[model samples]
Target: MTETDVVVIGGGATGVGVARDLAMRGVDVVLCERGGLGAGTTGRSHGLLHSGARYATADPEGAAECIRESRVLRDIAGEAVERTGGLFVQLPDDDPAAFDARIEACRDVGVPTETLSADAARETEPELASDVRRAFRVPDGVIYPSRLVAATAESARQHGADVRPNAPVTDIVVTEGTVTAVETDAERIEADHVVNAGGAWAGRIAELAGVEVPMAPTMGVMVAVDVGGVDSVVNRCRPPDDGDIVVPHVDRVVLGTTSTPVEDPEEFSTDEAAVEAMLSEGAAMVPAVADADVVDVYWGVRPLYAGDDGGRGRDASRGFQVHDHDVARLTTVTGGKLTTYRLMAEAVSDAVCERLGVTEPCRTADAELPAGDAEKLDALVEEFDAAGPADTDIVG
Candidate 1:
């Protein structure tokens, strides 16, 4: 018999951010997740806080969003973001002529970049291959998922939000063409508004409300190496493809990923071919990546929107979309990646406020997560380190 102003479905990054934003705005909110926090696609990410350099050439809009959100995350969630920076290295096989376009695109999108000669690149990253044709440095960083999500959820709870994990939402009660309540395994909670932040499972939630949304869940494989091969995030200066990025985390290097379409988000398995592709392609950017001991092999599903762009696989847009089912008093936010979760949440929250006739402006960008003190930052870092591999499954 719980009653709230809003009930958000899904416990991934977007759901956590939505709950945090709404609660901060003085809205009664409850976030329900089927499994543990970040147990969906968010937990399986490569943990790269993008600088927007990768998509600058092909998708400037997406790039602009990334750069803006990247800076915001650094200020608001400093404890989870490591300012390692990033590099886009061009191989001999890559078209050197295209480097100019890449630089221009990045600059146009307000993403700062510094060109480096092959020798300078090697000096910065000694493990870089000698045959590197060109290199450009940008403001990329690493994100600790478990710590970030946990801190965000804690902040929401402190602000009076009810974050319920393991409470799978089974049904959406529609009364007189409007959503009246959300039925979960433990209890039925009445809500004035509902948001589908379920990531890959968002489409299913929409179905429960007799609405249809195109959610194309794409799977990507990531391999974790035991050795920390490079300090900065390394990416191939070419079109998005399999295994073109490598992330150096604490005591480990993550190589990823291969994008392929899947009918069911839950139905995905990693094969030897995909693992080999990541190791081999990742090594091309950082030579030491190939020899590093393989510690873990996992995959994550991306909640991509199937737009009329008609693009598939790596060609699909990375931007997000917010759909409002006015009659049902429901909102569904999907697509985008972990780097832009806050922005996605803000967009959806704005829609909710519009419908509820609340005029509170979004303060998520200005508000920092509860961890800004040095002692608190250190404590969070220690907690993240303690979680280890066993906790990785809960991140996505």
Candidate 2:
């Protein structure tokens, strides 16, 4: 029988992050994932390291968290981030008034913004719409999701945490209103605490523990085109909308996304309409994107929490919530975005420590993850290099 102080279910960024934080604080942790690391929504993300400017107007709290976390990640996880700053372009057709508000919102939240003229913006990003009226630059970048997860998992393991991928949690052994063990396919692992960082599947895990977690699995479609013109992350100057953002990764530029509620997180399929809609919307920002060949089409499910009273789509609150089932000794961390995963982990870790009576404060914000496997990274780079220019650059 496996024994541990905490059992973390899920291997996405947040799960691994929580394990890393707890393990760093000298808490014995075991993280179990049903599939390979980053095989879920974390891998499907567009790789855009947010600067919080996107949500500055709609959700300032989330925006603030993102900016602070963004800087923190850049500091501690520098190797996993690409410093490709972001730009918000306002075309002549877009509302110029909204641009002013966005700038103010970013400023109010401590997200620096620099205004640029259409010509200046085009000079920086030639693919930007020629009719652009103004542009604002934000400290955005791209994050290597797979590398980040792997590094965090590795750090957790080094700190005496056990990370077991492909070990699905079959059941949560609740006895007398408190979780005592977690049943997996391989073994029954006993734990004093359980953290449900299952992302989209948090609702199912919560149900197993006999708790209600209202989660709306929302799907967003992203299309990758085999063309790279814009060098920075580009966004529409207006409110959050579908396909209004273009993120340039390694070789291909990723265009996305459309948000729609889905019944099952794992059962959604990509369709031609969604792909076309993304392309059509993205073309407004980068005209060359319309002519580029589509390299891939994928979708990611966001674990959007639908409380008794909350909005959906672009209106949904991006803030994260931690549900501490004190009686059951289980915690569910859900919502938030990739950029704010660190903060989410910190919050959840704080709760876990409080429940366990551990007074260790969170030091993940300043602590750097151990260096990644250099030989493995070199081998990957060699493989991608031999595969030709079509392969997405897998730089760490």
Candidate 3:
């Protein structure tokens, strides 16, 4: 039986990030995924590198975390990040009070903002709907999910972590309330500790260890369309709602999304009206999308913590929590945004290191990652088949 200091379940951003962080800190780690790297929530997101303005008013602490991590990513991830800047446009039909509150909250959360007049907003983004009354710019940008994941996995490997893709974890062996080993399709790994960084599948992973972790997953759809002249990420200035965001790529804008809780993250269905509303509501903000050619339609299930449920799935907190299962030596991390993935990994690695008696402070935020070279990054992505619907056009 092969042995590892720790076994990380899930090959998504958080799992790979944790592997990279732990490996960098001189810990032995083995990361396994059921599918290709990123193929989960990490690869399926709209790829927004949030400046935290989206949640500045509703979740100040989380918003603050996002802004801090946003800077870290922009600094370390290099070419993987596009500094497109973002706009929160207020329609004439929207609440002016909400716009003022957003400005106040952004200041409170340290999310920089600059208000732009209608003409100025139009000038900056010609494709912005003519009726867009006013807009504010923030430091939001875009992240290539597959590219970032490939770079992170590559970093983990360079740091001595074994990152295995398409190695589905089939079982977790618990002996007297302690996790002793993990069995994957590839092989059984004897591990001193196991981290369930399974994204939406965290609860199921916990179950394999005779532990329970409540997760309320919600499915949201993102539609990518080929359009021209849009250069910035555009978000509705009002409270979050369906089709409230339009994230730009080189040739398409990814319009998203609707949140509705599902019992099974793997078994949720999509709504046609919601898809139609994406084009309709997105068109309201950037009219050019009304006739844009559809490029792709994909969905991601949010790995929300059930304990934080506030009735409506949308009300569920975007904050994440690290759970130490009753089964000793098992930790489950759930609920977090891709923008703050590195921070989440640091937290999990810290927890694991403390248990292992390793005293290495996290340096992932400061040290630049590998895969800055587009060719190298794309090679790793192709090697792992990491391309997902979000960046299908870019890689492969």
Cα lDDT tens digits, model 3, 1-396, are 689999999999999999999999999999999999998898999999999999999999999999999999999997678889999999989999999999999999999999999999999999999999999999999999999999999999999999899999999999988899999886799999999999999999999999888888999999999897788999999888989999998889999999989999898778888889999999999998999898899999999988834443888879989988777999999999999999999999999999999998999999998857888888989887788887777664
Indicate the TM-score of model 1.
0.94
The 10 consecutive residues of candidate 3 with the worst lDDT sum are: 308-317
What is candidate 1's lDDT per residue for 19-89, written digit by digit as tens? 99899889999999897777778777888899999999888999999999999999998666788999999
Top candidate by TM-score: 3
The numbered model that scores best in lDDT is 3
Q: List the residue pairs that clash in candidate 3.
A: none
Q: Judged by lDDT against the true structure, how good is candidate 1?
A: 0.84
How many residue pairs of model 1 clash at the backbone? Answer: 5
The full ranking of all candidates by lDDT, starting with the best, is 3, 1, 2
